[model samples]
Target chain A: MLDIRQTVEKPRMREKISEFRVGDTVKVSLKIKEIIKEERNKKKGSKEKVTEKEKIYPFQGIVIKRKGGGIRETFTVRKESHGIGVERIFPLHSPIISEIHVLKKGNVKRAKLYYLRDGKKR
Target chain B: MIGLIGKKVGMTQIFSEEGKVIPVTVIKAGPCKVVQKKTKAKDGYDAIQLGFGEVKESRASKPCIGHFKKIGLKPMEILEEIRIEDLSKFKECDEIKVDIFSNSKFVNVQGITKGKGFMGVMKRWGFKGMPASHGTHRKHRHPGSIGQHTDPGRVFKGKKMGGKTGNEKITVKKLSVAGIDLEKNILLVKGSVPGSRGSALFIFSDLNVPVNLQTTQLQAENKPVSVEK
Candidate 1:
């Protein structure tokens, strides 16, 4: 409802995006490619009905911050993967994203949750 | 590749479909009218002059108004020429909008960079002046030496001495065409282009490169766009 015209020239491109807020837990479905070895090993006569297939890797992270506007907009999602803080920055209007699922919302005072790096948010 | 005369509307951030943050410059381009056409036989070249922006009839001089009337278009403030092999396709009074480069991948943006007042060699030319060490005096920002004094006795022509910097036409080549809004007549080109906001800019697609608007589309389909600004 904000002047969509001012930001993106194509609002239709933005139609697929889901609205979520900061401090929200979200799951991002990322398309990933993995080689199929077993299918390659089987002989041509066997007919396993498979060769290689693209897989979706779900990355669940908390919305630490959402920044920018229009087509240049991006958000940083932080999630502890393997005990290491992994923050993925995704452009909100990009075509690479498959889906964004908002899980839960958090109540915080600051706009940026950078303090989470220090484990203060926990 | 077609080019459009546009005014820099300023810069803003937008989210890609991958939810990545990209810095983009907003440009209000075109809706330009073809002012004149340069033909191979007449001018020994092929090009079309485009007029951009609107001018009030009251502020327009008689000659300028007559010129617009000859072309059957309202008065425009900026006029620029774009070359093409076939000039017959475009005639006077033909309207060109941002849609021409809608699906384009890369564009060459040209503008005059902001001018800085007279500056020293260090900031102006990136000359590493005298070091910040012991026994260094007023020679910090000074030009150590123009040249060997005995041989030439005069500094060579076009030496890298500092004087005025910027305020020159600069062309930013192959800037990605991030997005285009046909309704608003806005064009978003990826990365930083020269000149300040509200300054005039020219957008020309690189004919040699294949436009990959789908790279953005493919990425957008993968990530859901989300932004906070």
Candidate 2:
């Protein structure tokens, strides 16, 4: 039988996320909207209207986990910034993601690198 | 009020126009026919009964076949009556499509939740069990102290204990309507509804109903667009 759910979802899922797995280093580019309130003077005088602008925000990290299936899929990316570990989960088919760049492929035995959160082995 | 008989398809996350992720539950709603109408003068109330799904004539009972024949409509699998404030807007045998909610922003969904067979207190009532340490001794996940000492003597009535869970009618009100596919009769609701996949659902539109002012204020602050209490 034809599934109406699949038909409705097919058109929205236009992004084909790159094949990257746990321990692989990648970069994700997201289109973010920011509101810019312009000031007319050096003081708190604002004559100009607030403007909404879109910009590409990039994050480079190692893929730690990939969860879910199909267009509803999400993956976790972890990176070290100034000796602090930062993790972010991105939806695979989200329209906000502009590009996914795979930098290096990694060979690991586990699908999820959650053990890396405990302590730095390297 | 405008409503339809529908079935839950499944749940999925979709992207909003603002580049935000929204979890939605897809529903396949009615193109049902108004099988009968009960007028105020004759029946002492105004109600329109709708028929959903198709069934073979041989599979239906004699009375059901006659009921469909009276309205000149084909046999439908389920018949449900919806009480309404006005009956003049609709006629018997009139088809109610999924587009009835095109102008409506929200809807109330009602369905029978999936049944969990004979669950324990931990899973059913969300009761905190005894401590794992300190000589608890095989008393994990047990509901302690049903009643007080000899003063009360008996367990109080309607205590929060485990019993049959789910499989009961639940209504989730003021769920935002994300999108509607009129051609396929599919409705995309912005949040979760009752029941598992493939369960029967009643979708009541918020066309004439007044919007809750409190929720409209919350929506202005960019909170979740729901008023389900």
TM-score of 2: 0.81
Question: Which residue segments of model 2 deviate by more than 4 Å?
Answer: A15-24, A41-48, A103-110, A113-122, B129-157, B209-229
Query: TM-scores across all candidates?
Result: 0.71, 0.81
Q: Model 2 Cα displacement at A84 (Å)?
A: 3.9
Residue range B1-229, candidate 1, lDDT tens digits: 4788998877666665444567787788877888988887899767899899889999999999998898678888988887665567787788898888866778899999999979899997888999787899878887788888677788899788878888999999988887887877888888888888778888887663334433434554886544434
Candidate 2 i-RMS (Å)?
A: 2.2
TM-score of chain B of 1: 0.83
The regions of model 1 sitting more than 4 angstroms off are A1-54, A60-66, A69-84, A92-110, A119-122, B12-24, B38-47, B83-87, B98-106, B179-184, B205-229
Query: Retained native contacts per candidate, as fractions?
Result: 0.40, 0.37
Scored by lDDT, the top model is 2
Residue B185 miss distance in model 2 (angstroms) = 0.7
DockQ score for model 2: 0.35
User: Residue B79 error for model 2, in Å?
Assistant: 1.7
Question: On residues A1-28, what C-alpha lDDT tens digit does candidate 1 reach at each position?
Answer: 1243355535525576777888889998
All DockQ scores: 0.19, 0.35
